[model samples]
Target: MTKPTFDLQSHSLHSDGVLAPAEVVANAAAAGVQLLALSDHDTVDGVGEAIAAGARHGVAIVPSTEISAVDGSYEDLHVLGYGIDHRDPALAERLRAARADRELRAERMAQKLNELGFAVDDAPLAARRAAGKPIGRPHLAQAVLIHPDNAERLEREGHDDVSSFIPAYLIPGTPGYLARTHPTVFEAIDWIHEAGGLAIWAHPFWDIDADAEVLGAIDRFAAAGLDGVEVFYPTHDAAQTKLLADRCAALGLLTTGSSDYHGPEHRLFRTFLAHELHGYAPDLSKLEQAAARAAEAAA
Candidate 1:
């Protein structure tokens, strides 16, 4: 298979990703990705470093962020903002506030875990905060896995990694579950537009919500000025990809593809390049044009 030229969604240590920004860019270069975006959750703090690495590696980096948002009852929906001004002061402040919320949520999850008799270490969380890494459920899971008090129970339960712990404890209706508080999808789209970026729904099928609910939410988001949808993803089957692509065409919305690579350590899905996009030949022209316009506006 031909290597993909564009991988527009990824993460770095600024969020929950295992790799640093420069490391992620280096890997993208090695994978023959010509265009990339460091769309860290709720933060663009890694974009500057990734851009520098992209320059050195002859890759074009899009300043981007993946914002956690809600659509009606769907609380964990994400919106990817591309061609953003990473240095925008107002955007930075808003993201900082979002990260603060994440921290609070993490603390509450930790408390919940403790109430359930799972002692999670606070030191690791403090270290992550000191390093400016965003607190997330994965971090909490990792803490649980490492804490001496939970080791026996986790081992007996076959909970060996972060992923195993998440569904068992962190998700809604679980013992450590904490409902997220976030802006509406419309508000998130407006935030992206205000930052001179295009807001695209990220990995619609990846959400726990049903496909019909996702479709309905996307319709609502498109009507609210959402710029596009992530049509190609590792988890999307051929039918799902075709469905999203057709929907985007019908709605006059741009369609984009990405690996959503977190790093080698993430076990959820294998990294895919644009060429691996399921059942569809990617046409990134609309996305590129929109990104160009956003960049120009930011400039």
Candidate 2:
């Protein structure tokens, strides 16, 4: 069987995702992914295991991670690092701080939810994953489900999915939202380079504010050493994907695509293959090509 020339971005239990690193890679090989990037949110703890799994399945693994950044202009931004040195001490320290911020934010949000009568304890978020791993809204959402009030609410609303309850109240602009103190976008881009990685603006259309002028922001980010744009993402509708593709071409920026798979509802089985984006093949070759460039530049 021929290997598919595509790289899929995914997360693992190291972050908000449910699967362990090995399970994520196993699913990738099963899904016919030739290349996979375990770009777990704000952490790279799973990259090593994913790499080992890749070797076993004859699939290549690119050590990658995603970081949350506050561009200082936008409400929030996420940066994806490709070909990063997960072992780098500087990179590790940055991610550690970010995860700590996540913990703090979770505490604050849980406090607010309790004020609203959800009465969830912070223990659930801490124990949500392996010890010391970062926790996020998903864990909090699950914690709230165990609360009598929330259980009644979910039953009343007929919600069988925990994630389906998050955005309705926990996300930004909602009752339980608490903004995180993230690194500035420029600092994040530089951190990725310092860690021997190429930085890409990840899921811009989703992470950015709906009313923000996205193209103008992308142009500004390009000046901050943004290497590529995540043009092919599951959340991007066909028209939105095309707009991103055209913007990348106009800006002379590199392009990437991904399933951004987490688990279950966002499984690889249901996600669109990165290469099959409405006849416009996403340029994931940039992953390997930029790997060399990042190393040379960092050296």
Candidate 3:
């Protein structure tokens, strides 16, 4: 089992990755990633920068994004849209609305954290609002816990390190929880399809419900025209990966895998595995198939 020459799922400042879009392209080029996709969260804002850098670095940059959507049953489902026309008016509107909601949620969470005695100022929150990406809990974490310039002060004040801070204190339903609304998965698929892109269900293993529950959602989404299932996700260990692969096969759906890289934000799962990790190495052929389909559709 050798590593794939390219990886499709990744991020940059366009979303929550640690590096800028150019840096991400440069790093991937240096790492020998032949093809790269900067699937930032809800935004294709970095595509131009990534494409320009990829040209210089000798890598192919695919325009993509990870959209959070609610399914028919109102469950949160993430759809990875590839080869999207980022300038689509409807798509841009939705992304901007999502960003606005994120800012509101972040402000509410910050206020709540202040109530909890975390000395976190509104400045970091404000800056994130200005940056224009979704200011979710992770941004809050960067604001309050992980900003390296404040690391010593945070440690002296007894703050948990960056990793633990999110899970321990700021997860959904915690004291500072602020829920943000997202379009339904069906709506997302519709938008992506309308924009002439491909939408695939992301990380089946992370589905909150059991396999049957998630399958039920997938079944309904199939009618709305979902392109594939992410059977090969970074979080899916070997057994889970194989299970999803088999399921997608039986359903006659394309199967795919990716590193889900977010640079420093998720450094652990930043590259494609040559062999199985907990049992998954996505077949990149599906990605190529998706590309072909998108091209045909565009034509």
Candidate 4:
């Protein structure tokens, strides 16, 4: 099979990604990605900029967003909305609410960190909030890593990378962990549909809670109107990828592929158009049909 040229999941500084929207497009174009989705977490604010950059760089931009949602017994399960109307008022409102919730979670996490003696500076976090950028655990981790008070402790504890802080302190059952109060996965799927987009479960393998029950969760999500699953990902082994692809086929759901690129500075899954996804070509006809329907509905 020919390598897939489209990456359905990515991020920008509009969310947790370090690079700006145009920078992400330029990087994807340089990596020979023909189609790129600027699926920032909980916001499409960067999609317009990314689309313009794509036009300039000869790449197609799929207006998209990665919504952080939950299912029963599954927390922080991301749902990717592709080919969305970036300007949809209802979608914007819902995303705003989600981002607000994220801010609250981040704040609570920071407080917990402080209580645990891992103080986080409030200035940078305040600046991010002031600039309308989403507050994520990464930002908090950066704060923790950079604080003069925590430097010796972090170095002594062998926590040199931002990624190390996440599992150690910010995730569930940790000292700084704070539960998210975001929308349910089903509600997120409905929001994506209302905005004229296809809702796909993003990176099932990354969600530890859902990993063991991938096919079962796919059935549940499909029943709740999920349009697809990200069948090809950098972390998924051949067996896992094939399993997801076969299940998507059996269920008549779209199977998508992506690098889930955050940025080059990221410690893991940093490559755009990763080689792991090159073996499987995603059937984009389904996506095109969905886009056509969306356009017709708009018209």
Rank all candidate structures by their lDDT, best first, as comma-separated numbers: 4, 1, 2, 3
Tell me, by TM-score, which candidate is best. 4
Task: Output the worst ten-in-a-row residue range by lDDT, candidate 1.
Answer: 290-299
- For model 3, where is the 10-residue window of minimal lDDT? 272-281
The top-ranked prediction according to lDDT is 4
lDDT of each: 0.82, 0.76, 0.69, 0.85
Tens-digit lDDT string for candidate 3 (29-112): 877777677888888788777777877787776667888776544434688887777667888888787667666766788788
- Model 4 scores a C-alpha lDDT of 0.85
Model 4 RMSD in angstroms: 2.5
lDDT per residue (tens digit) for residues 146-187 in model 1: 888887999899999998999999987788888876777888
| Deviation in Å, model 3, residue 231 alpha carbon | 1.5
TM-score for each of the candidates: 0.92, 0.88, 0.83, 0.94
Residue 95 lDDT (model 2) = 91
Report backbone clashes per prediction: 0, 0, 4, 0
Summarize candidate 4's per-residue lDDT along 148-246 as a digit string, tens digits: 989899999899988998899988777888786569999999999999889999988878535559889999999989999988888888888888888
Candidate 3, clashing residue pairs?
70-185, 237-278, 238-278, 238-279
Tell me how far the alpha carbon of residue 145 in candidate 3 is from the true structure, in angstroms, after superposition: 1.3
Where does model 2 exceed 4 Å of error? Answer: 1-5, 121-123, 128-130, 209-212, 265-276, 289-299
